[model samples]
Target: MKKGVFLLCLALYAFSVTLTIFVQAAGIADEKLRLLSSFGSLISFFAVLAMLFLIFRLKDNKESKVKSCGQKQRKNPDEKNPSKEKYLEFAARNGLSRRESEIGYLVLGGLSNIQLAETLFISLATVKKHLTHIYEKTETSGRKEFAEKVKAF
Candidate 1:
């Protein structure tokens, strides 16, 4: 719908420009020619504004979708999955903090540092900090070792 509106505005602007040019070349009266030129300029200005508005709207929508999807993926790990429940229990057993446990669960699920950061709405440094804490608490060196240990549950 937005694209269609943008296209229609562009067409109207083009038609207005053509009309202004035709009026100019046809030797119309000065008053009428000025009026047509002003009308054309107004049409062009509005068309540009509409196009910009649509462009920004589209960009905002895409960004919103990404944030919402990230939020959805960040849902509580213990909600429905048996494996996640076990993982959370394991995290608790190992004395991991809540934030550390969350990061650990994502790591176990094979999320990269960047994915973890985006999904949890934290900085990459924060995610790394959580991972470090998780590793220390679980007696693991890194993601691979942690995954191996968690799977052993």
Candidate 2:
């Protein structure tokens, strides 16, 4: 809709410029020619403004869609996913330390050891150690069992 309006404005500007040129060639009075040229200039200015408005409008529309999609994807797929407080509470009940809980959260999100190490600024060995502790504290072994325990929280 905005693009259509802008294109219509551009066509109007072209028409006005053509008319002004013809009026000038026909030997109209200087005052009349000046008025006609100025009118065309005004139309051209408005056409440019309309085009700019449409560009910005389209950009904002695209930005809004991307923002909404990002927010939607950020939602957890499982309806039974615990809130932050609930997750921390469950981790505490299972005797996991704060760092272990943080690691467990990322682990449950399916991050690999190298990815977890990079994200947490820890060594790969440290990531493996944290996972071992988490498994021990949660009484669950390996990725599948660990994830099942976290989800069952």
Candidate 3:
């Protein structure tokens, strides 16, 4: 969409430039009319250039935001969580399956059951079932105990 708009603006600018040159070469007798026409064409040309610049800037900002968001989501599990290694070790020690360990990580990151379901793209009941299995495997009573045990590691 932005590219189309930019192209259209470019075409309009080119047309305006050609028209202005043609008008200048036509040798009109009225100086005032010629000056007014030149000024109008100049203004339209600058407007088209401004629109193109703004569109490009907007596209750049949108692309940067999308890239940053993707990077942030992918990096958060390890980079932002200081206890990731400890959690992994804890998971390994407890013989947690991959899914349970993922749930554990999100739980440690302070996600609620609903958030866990949303983040993991699972149903709420599935999240609860995973938590139950995690609790049984880790031999912890609940989230608090699990978190305490992992942190103590």
Candidate 4:
């Protein structure tokens, strides 16, 4: 994360420097207006690049998390939860308690165990226990893959 921010800052700095150089070189008759345009363009370019980078990073994280959860689930098949047609069905099939089911849902939604616990008003230890049960039932080894399976259900 720090690296990403650093890179973005570096990119912005380089862009600004380049824009200054270009404006100086163009030496248009309207020096003030040309400098302004160059500055504006640089700002716009950097903004677009930053937005794109953020979106890409978010998407990549989500996909990777999903993959990790799925791989975990595949590693253990003995803990097959019940097969409900709906998302609720997943909870029922898995024999997860009401709270466990809720936690599981959150986990499936890409929340970390700590995040889920906080959201659900539970202790981290309790959250881990619930996750253990969830993993056992869902046969997921990681949060990402578990989330994928839950989403599919």
Q: In candidate 2, how many Å is residue 117 off?
A: 0.4
Q: TM-score: which candidate is best?
A: 1
Strongest candidate by lDDT: 1
Locate the minimum summed-lDDT window of 10 residues in model 2.
66-75
Model 3: CA > 4 A from native: 1-82
Off by over 4 Å in 1: 1-82
The digit string of per-residue lDDT tens for model 3 on 32-113 reads 8687668759867786877869788987876765444333233245534436777888899999999899888878776778
Cα shift from native, residue 33, model 3 (Å): 59
Candidate 3 residue-wise lDDT at 132: 95
lDDT of 4 by residue, 65-104 (tens): 5555443333345544433346678778878788877777
Q: Please list the C-alpha lDDT of all candidates, in the order they appear.
A: 0.78, 0.76, 0.76, 0.68
lDDT (10s digit) by residue, model 2, range 1-153: 877887898898788778778777787777877797879878877877887888899888767654443332223465344567877888999999989998877666556676677566688999899889989888887977876676677
Model 2 segments beyond 4 Å from truth?
A: 1-80
Q: What is the TM-score of each predicted model, taking all chains together?
A: 0.51, 0.47, 0.48, 0.41
Better of 2 and 4 by TM-score: 2
